[model samples]
Target: MNNFVKTTVLGGLIFLTPIVLVVAIVGKGFSLVHGLAKPALQVLSVETVLGAATIHIVSVVLLVLLCFLAGLYSRTAGAGRLGNWLEKRLLEKIPTYPLLKAKLRSALQPEQLETLQPIMVRFDDSWQFALLVEQVKPDASLVFLPGAPDAWSGSVCIVSGDRVEPLDVSVQRIIQLMKRLGEGAAPDLSQLRFGAHEA
Candidate 1:
């Protein structure tokens, strides 16, 4: 009986969640617009600069114009270069900036980076886990261990070559597993081996 009730509630949530989310988002957006307009309307009316409807219309028009300008700027080569320059400069000034940059770079790195080599980690000479290399130094290596909830970001360990195993896996597959199962799960190698043998 308890299991039946739990299953029913879970099934209902699975079916209704998207609809609820959409309605909540729309309602919140409307509330925010109303809040902003209420204060703006009071100020505009005191000066007789615009009626409530006119003020709302003007605000919307200004927002659209700003958006258009922003879109144009983003598409321009000069703006793109400026943005990148600013990002690098700002990152250099902040103490925690390099860590954030590393995470972002790891996340956005090309899929080709994933196929370079899989680091095989052995635990006590018996257990083994595979990791994708994020960066490597002479003494330490940055490896992304697939963990539950998020896979793109993982521990940065200083592992020796003897402690690491190298595997030939495509970057795309690693990314797919990261995206689908977070870090807690990985692609099933046994299945792949069986399929390869069958083919």
Candidate 2:
């Protein structure tokens, strides 16, 4: 009974942490942008035209414009060098920053998602679905074992290539399966081996 409660609570945390972090980050950014734009709105007396709602509308517009400008700037060669410098010198120092960056990139960039190959990893008597992150060596593969309920909280492992079977499935499909807590995965689950490992 205690183990079940602990497991359930942990699963809930895993599912909520990403959502909470995203909401908190966006809220903080909006607050900062709104604070900066508030004085300007008051100076221009825009409140007289739109009344109380003007501040929010103006803040949102400014935030969107700022995001557009930043995206444009990041496309330049200098931005690439600056980004690398910041990551190596400052951003990488923060423990969660790298993981956050990778997750964000994977979410926003389709090409990054394409690179993550779906596969089945032999784990004792059962098979676990994972993403083939990279080929660490000729016989060793780096894989991401996604956690159920929240795929982002997965763990990375370097396993033997022989134990990893590449699947004819998409990364998005695998993520959806994880998000659904492996429901409707009977066809895939049927492939799990018993007793002995396969070559």
Which one wins on TM-score?
Answer: 2
For residues 1-199, could you state the per-residue lDDT of candidate 1 as single tens digits? 9999997787566445545654675567555656676677677664445555665565566555655788799789999998789878774674434444544456666653654465556545342335646547665566656432234334555566555655556555555565665343345453222222121
Pairs of residues clashing in candidate 2: none
* C-alpha root-mean-square deviation, each candidate: 10.5, 3.0
Over 4 Å off in model 1, which ranges? 1-109, 125-140, 178-199
lDDT of 2 by residue, 91-174 (tens): 788655655665688688957789889998888667888999899999999999987766767899999987888777788888
CA lDDT scores, all candidates in order: 0.55, 0.81
Off by over 4 Å in 2: 47-49, 89-99, 188-199
**Model 2 weakest lDDT span, ten residues long:** 190-199
Which whole-number lDDT from 0 to 100 does residue 46 have in model 1?
46
lDDT, model 2, position 49: 64
Q: What's model 1's TM-score?
A: 0.38
